[model samples]
Target: MMKRKILVLKYSFLAILLILLNTFNVNGQDEFVKKSFTTADPLYTNLLKATEGNFKNYPHSFLENGNIKYYQIDEWTGGFWPGSLWYMYEYTKEEKWKKAATAWTNSLESNQYNTKHHDIGFMMYCSYGNALKFDDNPKYKEILIQSAKSLTQRYSPVVGSIQSWNTRKSKGDINLWEYAVIMDNMMNLELLFYASKVTNDPVYKNIAINHAAKTMQNHLRADYSSYHVVNYDPKSGKVLHKQTLQGFSDESTWARGQAWGIYGFTTVYRETKDKRFLKTAVKMANFFLDHPNLPKDKIPYWDFNVGQPGFKPDWDFDPKRFKETPRDASAAAITSSALLELSTYVKGKQKQKFYNAALAMLKSLSSDTYLNTNNANPYYLLKHSTGNLPSNREIDVPLIYADYYFLEALTRYEKSK
Candidate 1:
């Protein structure tokens, strides 16, 4: 009887040990996340500390004059601040972030009905879409559906794509881009895809699919590098011209535009699980990763093909302009998130390459050069992001979307482990 009792106890001990081992094995991401939080926690705390009294205003981008520039509710980037708050809320599970997210997100309620252009995805999906993802509030869902409706108002069946921008207001805008369908616009389809799933309506999904298919066919160049904008004749749905408004030239690859393509197609794959989208995403990623001009740190210059041999901008556009070009941390953050997601869907060396590239980018962004925890800016993180460098606007400033995607990448990394 004594021997039997001892044997039972030994078996129980072994079972407990095995259970604990399984728990650790399943939570490798959590372990890395805990280590990361050691660095991230203070940055967020300092951010809240810096923005203590400034949360009322919606910060869009920073100015070189050392001031936080505010934007109206209708501004394309207005939702990113609130989206960042939601990500922080998700990471920390803190009440303050939740409260802040609610306040900022509610401020954009009127945007649900605004039909000026096709950025409701950036304006609503980044804000409310994340709100629903973390909290699953029905009100957020309704607002997203309404925003999707507003976005569809900009889609033209003739063009088979959503219109990106209206007529350019100034010389700073892209030349020959009147009725444009930009690569950046592909990022907006996430909102429509989500709306379709929630409402059980195929129209929204179909619109997103059509737009993506059209953009995939037209926007990408022969080498898989993307054009910034494709001007289409609104009347006949004909391609009028292709121009690179924000890139070095019409022929060069804008780093952020490439990042947008990777992110958008990866997202499309996520929503639809279509192998074609995944393949397209891989093609874009390969172009970006294997490009000769890509910085060794995995951060890319504002444009990759700026000064390659035989590369000349339109009309003596200064081929030497690539000297000391600025890095777009925003692109790095966006690409990191996309590659992390792509890693899960792929296997073998492709998966390893994608995961390693994302990890390297994340590490680079977390450094002091890019991660701004200093008191100079309290409401934002990550600096040196270039926005419209051609116009000399928001150069080397902290963009709100940069912070939004950085937090998202971190969240994805944590959950993946």
Candidate 2:
């Protein structure tokens, strides 16, 4: 009888231990969610307020020529202002941000028909896309569809790509763009894809697919780095020349161009669920991540191959004289957001690696080294972004899009966790 009683006490102790472990697991999970999701970054609000104040004066792109300024509706960066406001609203659920976003977005209504360049996506979708994502407003849908249609006017069936620019002759007596397609054009494809979804039309989707496929075939090097522009014969679709308009050289990888490629392809994969795009994105990301020139913080120089030996590229000024070349925070912000999205679609070590790299970039960008906390420049969030280094324009300055993508990365991080 005594032995039986001892056995019952042993089973009771085991049951109690199991209950305690289950409780501990639940509490651990709750702690993780509370720490990651519920905690908001105070910087977001501070930067947004700063931007609001600056917008009251400038009402457009961030600082230019050491002064606050605005841009035309067709400017490549015009949509970023509204897009950033949308992101602010997305993060905070604040109505003031939404009102500002709507006002800025409406200011771009004329841009729906502007076909002067391939940046209509950046102008329209970045602003309206987020609005539609949350509000499902029919007006945003109509504007985006019209913008996509306008973009389709630039596609060339013969070249299987979208034309980026018209012909131009440089002082060196070199003529460009009988048919020019740029790496930056890849970013515009998203608007077309989204239009296809909303309109139930395959034409827009097909154009984007053909352009992507052709670009994959002709623009990328074996190492997965991309050319900034590829020119072709308009009539016969014959390849004419591959060149770098913004990069250090025809052989170099422009950091922002590379970032655009990764983000573009990752987005394509998300829209289509095509494994080929995912594979391509992975390859391109590997090239960027593994390159020796990549900084320890993961923010890259303006052009990856610029400072290397044996290459001389034309720039408006000499890059070699600078003690250290400027880093592109815009590229880092775009890449970090793309990497966070890419991590969700991948598995195993690759997934963890992408996530960790994105987290590191966020940490670096959030630091005083990059983050613009000083009220000195309330119009911008992060500083030291490079734009058109070859042309001696906006180098090491804060760009509107940089702030947009930084907020975007933060929002994505909150959701991803």
Candidate 3:
């Protein structure tokens, strides 16, 4: 009789512990969602004040002199501000945010035909993509299809990848790169994949698949760390140079580039349901999460190999100043958002691991260390993002895309709960 009583007591205690753990998880998610919107409300309002209610120019980042920098509709970052507004609208279902998002998104309509670069995905999809999610506007679909068509103009059958940049001289190199396909190009595949799904045309999806396969073949190192830029021979379709335009060195992995790879590959897997892309994404994510240089808070330095021996760039800045290196909250935001989606695709321990990592990133980003609560940079949300360290531009500043993905991660986290 005593033994039976003890067993019952032990089972009751275990059940109560499980209930407490579940409640704690739910409360934690609720806290993050509440804090995220509370901070975003003021930051976006300040952006409106700074811009004087003008939706023509998109907020990019703060300049070194502490002025808010604005980009034209054609700039690569043009979509993020509108995308963020759409996220706000989605979360609150407020007509004011919807109106604001529509106004900002309308400013980029001309970008539908922009074929000068491969960032049309970032420019058009991010803005219109989120807009279509909330409102079933036929015009949005039309614009997105046209944008996808324009993006295909950069795709080369020879290289089996979209050209990121036209013929241009890389920094510190005298030879002009005939064709460059960057890790960032992987992100643009989503627009193509979407186009394929909406229109039921295999052409767009085929291009995206070819690009992903080629990128997997050449852009990733053996350990899944990605190269920032891979220059190719336009005529021969041969890889001429595998280099870094934004990392600490040609051999070092740039944090944002790696984040792009993880997010991009995960997206491809989602669109195609191909196991190869999923495998690649898992490997790349593990590389990032397991890297030795990642900070305790999960925010990464601009480059993974910063201050590591023999990983110096030809730029003027000293690589030995890794301790003083700027942390990229943008990378953290992007990775957190991607990890949320990735967690849904996996099961068991991997799912828990990815979800926990995303939660940690959100916790750190929402903390005082990264969140901009003082309105010091009225136009941006999160701080400490490094845009381009080699050129010494926008280092340790609040970037617009950082806020976009941070809000996205928050919304995803709330939904997962």
- Which order, best to worst by lDDT? 3, 1, 2
Error of 1 at 280 (Å): 0.8
- By summed lDDT, the worst window of 10 consecutive residues in model 1 runs over 169-178
Residue-level lDDT tens digits of model 2 in 330-414: 9999999999999999999999989988888887787668876554464567788988877777777888788788888888877
Segments in model 2 whose C-alpha atoms lie over 4 Å from true places: 1-66, 315-317
Error of 2 at 15 (Å): 18
- On TM-score, the stronger of 2 and 3 is 3
Residue pairs with colliding backbones in model 3 are none
Q: After superposition, how far is residue 395 of candidate 1 from its true place, in Å?
A: 1.2
Best by TM-score: 3
- Candidate 1 regions exceeding 4 Å error are 1-56, 169-176, 315-323, 373-376
Residue-level lDDT of model 3, residues 73-158, one tens digit each, is 77799999999999999888889889889988988999999999999999899999999988899999999999999999999999
Instruction: Give stretches of model 3 more than 4 Å off.
Output: 1-21, 319-323
Select the stronger candidate by TM-score from 1 and 2.
Answer: 1
lDDT of 3 at 351: 92
**Cα deviation in Å at residue 97, candidate 1?**
0.9
